[model samples]
Target chain A: MRFSVLGVGTSFVESAMAETHGFADCDMNSQLLSPRLRRRMSSATRLALTAGERACADANVDVSSVPSVFASIAGEIKVTDTLCRNIAGRDFPLSPTQFHNSVHNTAAGYWSMVTKNKHAAQALGAGENTWVMGLLESCCQLRSLTDKVLLICYEEAAPEPLVMGEQISDCAVAMLLGIPSDKKRSVCIYQQRVEHAGASTELWSPVSAALALAKAVRHPQNSSKLPISSTAHGWYAEVVHGE
Target chain B: MKQLSQSIPITAYSAVTACGLGNTPLYMALESGKNCLQPLELFHIDIPTCVGEVREVLPEISESLRRFDTRNARLALATLNCEKGSVRHAVMHAIEQYGADRIGVVIGTSTSGMYETELAYEYFRDKQHMPESFDFLNQHAWGATADYLKYELGLSGPAYAISTACSSSSKAIASAQRLIASGVCDAVLAGGVDSLCRLTLYGFSSLELLSEKPCTPLDKNRQGINLGEGGALLLLEKPDSQHADRPHLLGCGESSDAYHMTAPHPDGLGAQQAMHIALTQAGLSTKEIDYVNLHATGTVMNDASEMKAIKAIFQSGVKCSGTKGITGHTLGAAGAIESIISLLALECGMMPGTAGLTEADTAFQYDVMGASETTASVRTVMSNNFGFGGNNASLIFGQYADNG
Candidate 1:
């Protein structure tokens, strides 16, 4: 029920984390991917890799050795919309690269290739509860395997037609969690059971869960509880920062 | 790397493919060595290709679930409706034993209601406006299938969708096992469903990975894959003393190739690792395996790499076949569909042969089933499903024994 948060990474609004001491720019550079692969990656993939690499660097862990779970609300909308447009045009041939990168796990696959991480990589989608579910899956992995898990959650703005008046944005967050040790500045994540109720109205957006979790991590307080997100069974996450 | 202390049971499962609407027809086709692939007819494409389209006239969704209707969801509903609604029966039973909140749903899908989006786009192009009936929230969402299934079944547990391409469903099964093992849930509905669409058809064709003829895995003249569509679901539960007769999900091994975006490793290192890991976790040696359902999509690289991995693992005695020659590659649903086929092999004591394979490739030293079904006393079987992102997964299923 307890784990250490060794590192944290975020790529939300530009310059939001720039003022923090340990935080770096949220920009996704071409350092982790080749030019060709970088060009082929969608915005979601870039955000995920950027946050994952930064977390690994911040934690002083090798990216290739860790198992990872990537979560997203909407995956590769740009590529999907483009493909739909091409199909509507009765186009004989669609772009092969776009099709390959269109899968929801494209970013996870690209991360593996970039870091040569052969361990298990999982990609999941759960409407607004993606971040919490990703954390839950990672915690389960850590408990079962006795190893650190890299959890990354990202969301890309859906196209205009798909968004249909909803306000979606681009953001990514990554965390390294494992059994708490004597390591410096490690926060404990506690998973608790709560009563079933309607989803909370506080910052109810796809990216809000990760943003809230990041805020708590950056500015630690005494046992501050943050509501991650609610699931069908009213299962949600609340992080407890250790003193 | 730790092994599961107890085995999980696959209490119920159903599959709908071009071979047939239910498990019986699929099993019959495998027994008779029938190939159900025909020229692609579900959609219009300028290229000549073949696909394993579900020929059964799918039943329309009920009025209440009309908003969730799509080719993908309909295929899923049809597959779930198979075995006389065995999945529903199993779920309801689980709800009685474990609270509805104690059951979880994990489904895998690559394209969920994408065909509807394509249609809406077409309508927009012609009419200069989107159709009023188009429901993007219900149809275009990647988590639509899982949400719909959860709503239909009225299960209030953790539900999500895994979208790791072809390995999606296989990983979904693995994730469900984790949920049970972690004590987060007592039972889970785990599987995958993907319906054929113009996006996939034209996409594969553009990649030059689509074959005009039926795919011939391990054949000397194997060219490429023949894409197909279908749905497969499995109800996995934590086994106790009472559930002794259910088929056991022995173990699941997952690994990323980290080699390429689409192409597999030439030496099949990741595939071998997955098989080795699965065997280790199952506490069984390679000699104990009786059959293997290969991820051979018939593409030159895919078949060759998979053969290397299979040869390295089982060597000679184990029987292996790629049913994609019959079912075609079902994309994200391939893992679950093939797992169901593996379970069928265990139950029926019949090893399905590669449907379209004529001349076996001489480069590999493994037993690849040909057009004839191999009747053996199958005990332990393995199914491999590797996907576009170099994502690889292998699952081991064993015949349930009362003495265990």
Candidate 2:
């Protein structure tokens, strides 16, 4: 049984960067989100939520009924820093509110809470193929019960000094999937288990899989593609074949 | 989906914990009724404590996998000696042996690399400078663990990390089964690991959830839960003619009560839904269950809610116990660890006791096993794990043959 990719939305570095790539300009500074939610939300979450919402809209999905798989390479790195600071000092007093939001599942939790989705919801993260894994998980969820699964993948450029020369850019991408009813802009995903006998490098996060995916969605001519990312144990490579 | 009328098999497994470096030691400890819990000495905890810490400090990997500099990464790297390419090798071997391309990995963890993130904050603030050696790549979020694992294992099929508090790992297993049954994957790696961190300890302490002494689950004088660290992995594959000896996953059920954030529903509505889901998914009546691994965390609210949930579903006289008293609650890792205990009970025919269970609460009528082992003819076993925000999951495993 083959599943069809429905719609994809991505929020990347400012519009200036997109302009260079001949991509449509999406207002990065647009105030589409509530101030309070935006205030508390890390850039990763805000971008992720926005991208997911746009993709859901593109897929013509009722966000309330769909099961969502929100994937991130690092969830709320800022909160982790806050907690660490509190713990390292004398009289370590953790912020009860921040502590609750710090749960890696918080993004999905907020999605469910905000959308009032009683359906199954999950938050997933993998270092390398965050996008590929998110898609697989989404496909699996749809195969199990739901007809459609929303997969949101995102990563924020680590602040000031996060090694890797902090060259990592902030971006979020969301894709909605279902049995292909619409043919236009649709891509098919097939599962392959192969040994990754490739050169390894110091990559930032597996969310790069999402970047590769966005590229695929934008450029269908490159149907047969292979995107690989590193893990703590080895490497996971996603090979897309066929139109 | 309804419970599989046939059995599912566990073809391979890997584990890293204080109980031992691998699964054999863990099984032996459970069989001999050994408690891995000891005085806490791994990290800085002001309170007196008991923990299930790995006896040996795992060495650094010679050829490091990723540049994410975090304590959680260190722990993950330390635990990474599972025969290079064991995971992907197992998947390919399974495909060759069973003829299936659907394979996945479901991991669980509460705090991914928060320990390292925390350290980064201090370094940035104190010195007003970022360390040249500090690589913040993988330490930014909890998904890194799952991300790193997928890449490390070369699993491009399907993977996700479940972070439902203490039940995280257990939920991962449930998801893996669902994926397998739905044909999303032919096999899956399901388990969990959580390294101890000051953020977790201080957070729990602030909420008065950590026990000042060794945790005593189900005891009248029970205090609270002891935070722990570790990981466990179970390779799940669909049943085939050649793999007749594998244990079967019968059913899995999940629910959320929408109750208080840190506390459970007073009436156990979510817990009941989860238990009923498990039984219903398995297509078996409550009477068929041989034993229950309860989510008895020793917190007054948690214990009370679990008791209420259990009594609400099971008929009187069904035997159930919490193994947390022995291993302490490993938080997100608890579900995976307890799952091991449940399988061990089925395989070894010996039920590990509720080590710290003493005075039985008279409010509930179920049979609560005291601090001792029992050998019984077990056919089906159930394990429960609940997390913050009323997230709960229950899994049922049957004898290999009866599973089908």
Best by TM-score: 1
| Candidate 1: tens digits of C-alpha lDDT, residues A1-243 | 456788888775455543342346677663787878767788789888988988888789999989899998778888988888788887667999899989898998999999999998999987766666677678777766547889888877777667634443577788877765554445444444555654333324555567666667667663366656653224343444455
| Lowest summed lDDT window (length 10), candidate 2 chain B | B78-87
Which lDDT value does model 2 have at B310? 88
TM-score of each: 0.94, 0.82
Return the TM-score for candidate 1, rounded to 2 decimals: 0.94
Model 1 steric clash pairs: none
lDDT of 2 by residue, B1-404 (tens): 42344456776555666677665676666555566788777666676667767657665533556455455555554444543535446666865654533567687889776666556556777887755555444555456565566556545456667787777888899778877777767888788878877778778877878887777777778888887777767778876766676678877777766555678888788788888877877777888888898999989889888988888888554678887776668888888888877887787776766776668766655568875465767778899998875678898887664543
Q: Which tens-of-lDDT digit does each residue in B1-404 have in candidate 1?
A: 54566678889999999998889999988877777789877767787888989988887777887777888889988987888999889999999999888898888998888878888999988987778867665677777788778878878777888999999999999989888987878999999999888888888888999989888878989989988889999999988867678888888899999999899999899999999988887888898888889998999998889889988887756778888888889988999999999999988888988887788888876668885465657889999999888999999999874212
lDDT of 2 by residue, A83-195 (tens): 66566554466777678767776666656555655445666766555666666666666665567778888776664544334334576777787754554455555534345
- Which regions of candidate 1 fall more than 4 Å away from where they truly are? A16-24, A164-168, A180-204, A230-235, B372-376, B401-404
> Judged by lDDT against the true structure, how good is candidate 1?
0.82
